[model samples]
Target: MELVKEIFQHLNGWGLTAILFIVGILEFSFGLYKKWKLNDKLVDLASILFGKLLMPVLVSYFALQLLPKVAPEYKEIFNWVPFWWGFFIICIADDLTQYWYHRLHHEIPWLWKFHRTHHSAPYMGMAMASRQGFFYTLLFPQTYVTTTLVFLGLGVPALIARGVKGLITMMAHSSIKWDKPFYDNKWLHPIAWVMERTISTPATHHAHHAAHDRDGIGHYNGNYGNMFFLWDVIFGTAKITRQYPEEYGLEEYQDDSWYSQVLYPLVKSDKPGSELAE
Candidate 1:
């Protein structure tokens, strides 16, 4: 346990990159061999490259310049607290910021264009974490917030938050559906409901990836919560469909190469009806 705790201390900027790399590799391999979902592969690869490689570095650069002035008292606060309290604050703030950014992705057209790459995947797995568009992470508020926290002398806690959030979000998107067996047990409903309402579950997150508004749709526009579903309930965006999607991915997507998906937003394609063609 001591060594395990020490490894967590080493997880900062580059550490996050390494962690994401291992996760992306495991998910990609599973997605290719067992799940073998072609449409999802492009999305997985794009998200990893953009979210992991470009976004954090850019956010940290800007955050470092601002944090010294914005939250100079952070170290003082850190000094006063027990370590776990600081850790909890970073984790909660990180997720709260992510919840809004995620909700915005569904409502804003420009943001939707980027976020759709994630919804474009027909299947969910660990790789689903990597299903974002190139440059998409630049607009993510959570990335900025996490970076700011780090620069404010809450760096270790921010890393801890990232690791915890990653585990929750990735598990929620994983192909393994964990809710089914629990459902038939009458004893579990109250506990499950409380947990689901407070935090995200596979049932809720999978519903976001759903394709349409029909019974099969899983109510995609709602359930915009990240680690905590309560954010949705509090904000009036929560959807409570306990069912998973019969079908997934954008209803209108046509196959495009990885190049087009990554570059079109920046390059502006001429392809007819392309998302960026206009």
Candidate 2:
């Protein structure tokens, strides 16, 4: 456990950046770079700068400070629990919270405005993974859950689970389509079945980002899992087609500026019909 924590601590700063660059290069090499627009790049850059990097650090700092005052005695309460057990608890709590959080973002009108930026991208890639509204990132439920768990002495396992989740999310959003081969090969079908059920895969996640659902391949309302697909399965929101969508993004999208996309409601858009407009 100590070794895992040490390794993650060493790589934490550069890991996400490295993954983005690597997957971005692969997307470029495969000629999918043309699919990206200038606005898309700008939104993605803003999201990475604000949502992934700046906001998380700021939130974590506040969480750390505030948690102690609210419940100091609860600190490291789960430290004595077995490592695997702790990890299991985190997987269930963090992922399930995220599942509902994500589902609600689509089901509710006000919440959808904040989450709209994520699905605004016309294409899927490593960059789009970070394309979220600033406030949406700030109030992410999993962040609070994970932060509280860490305060309760589940730091090491929580970090490890976070690392694993990060990797899965990055791949799930990447244009590389890593899960395709598993569905294609006859012998790998068994492994693929288990994998698709166990975790979010490119096919399953892309379906969620699909612009429309009339095609049967796109499932914008379902497959709301983050780290684990089990939550979706158990909750009856799972959709697995082993197929990719022809198009992505919102069915009815407004051409809101990058600023409005990232900092909506706080920084309203000048566009007359935009949801972010006053």
Candidate 3:
């Protein structure tokens, strides 16, 4: 267990980066890069640099500092638990919490402002996966939960689970459409049925990014699962279209500056009548 914790402390960030890089290559090869506008590129670049890379470190630092001071007795409380048990705990606690957190961002008006930047992109690809508002990235429930779990002595299994979740999330957002084959081939339909019910896939997640639900393929209000699709199914928010949306992003949008999108409220958009302007 000590060895596993040591390895994760060294490799967590690097492992995530390697996954992101590989997915980026696939996106580029598949021509998803052509769909990106200048603003999209700007937001993506900032998100990769700050949102995914810098923010996690800052959050972890603060969490580690604050947790010990506030709850010293709770530190390493779950260290004795077996790895598989810890992994299962994260899958339910972290993933299910994220599902509700994501769903609330759309259903609640105030939170939507923070999460809207993620849905601003007009395409589905790895680049848009991390295009989140600065505060949104920092305040994400999963981030706090995962960090807390590690502090509770589940570091090794938590890191492994996080890596698995990251891979699934990147694939779901990528333009590769890997799930399409399962939907297209009759022999593979059975696998799609089981897979879509278990974890998120490109088809299920892209529908959540659709501009509107009028297209019959879009389910903007549903399919909020980040890692596990089972949460959506259990909570009655699941939508399995087995198809991609014709368009992505909001039905109504303003040409807000990338700065405002990444660092909103701190840097309001100059565009008149924009959400960030307020």
Candidate 4:
């Protein structure tokens, strides 16, 4: 635990990228070896990695540079905040912001052009987590939030929160499905209830990735909560079937090139049936 704390404190920006890359690649490989669904969307996976690499750094830089100028009076909150409280606040805020952006990406046609890359995968995995459109990262609020917190000298705590969040997200997206045993435990009902309400579980998040489209568009891409389900629960967007989707991926979309997925928001696809081209 002490070593973990030390590493968290010492973790550099570049180091975070390296960790995500290594872990992501491993997850990608796991999906490939297991023949997990969506194996054909490797290009989409690569695009997500590129977005994570470039967009976070670019936005974080600008956010850090501009935060003080925009919210100078909030210096006390940013500077002298308690470490744990600041960590919790930032993490919750980050997830809440992400939930909104994710929902909007699905609801708004233009943003969906970029977010479609994520849903393009026919199956879920940690690697799939990175498979987002190039512009998707540009508009991600969490990156800017991290940047602001880092500039405020809360970088360590912010990174720690992100790392913890990433770990959960990665596990939640894994094909392995860790929640099965817990969910099946007859005596674990109370704990399961609390866990599902408090943090995102595989069952909860996977349901978001379900690939159907009715008022129940189980797969139409609406639910977008990250760490917490409360945002969805409170905002009237929560879905709680606790069942995984049998089929995944966009309902009826084109199989565009990875390049198209990366550049679609800016370049726009001209192909018929293409989300952006349409």
Candidate 3 residue pairs in clash (backbone atoms < 3 Å): none
lDDT of 1 at 162: 75
RMSD of every candidate to native, in Å, equals 3.8, 3.0, 3.7, 3.8
* Clash pairs, model 2 backbone: none
Candidate 1 C-alpha lDDT tens digits along 1-278: 66445545555545444555565577666553354456556656766777766775777668766666766666444545556877888877888888878778789987777776677676676666666667666667777766766665676666667776765676677666667566668899888778778877878888888777687548778888777788888988778767778777767754555555665567654557867665
For model 4, what is the error of residue 143's alpha carbon versus the real structure, in angstroms, after optimal superposition? 1.3
Residue 27 in candidate 4 has what lDDT?
64
Clashing pairs in 4: 210-219, 211-219, 212-219, 213-217, 214-217
Could you estimate the TM-score for every candidate? 0.80, 0.93, 0.92, 0.81
Candidate 3 lDDT over 140-175, as tens digits, reads: 888888889889999889887988888789889988
lDDT of model 2, residue 182:
99
User: Which segments of candidate 3 are over 4 A away from where they belong?
Assistant: 1-11
Name the lDDT of candidate 2: 0.85
Per-residue lDDT of 20 in model 1: 51
Expressed as tens digits, the lDDT of each residue in 1-278 for candidate 4 is 67455555544444444555665577666654353434345655566667756765677558656677887765445667778987887788789889888888788887777788777677776567777767776677787767777776676678778877766666666655667776789798788877777677777777777666453537345456777777877887777665677767766653676667777656766567776665
**Runs of candidate 2 exceeding 4 Å displacement:** 1-13
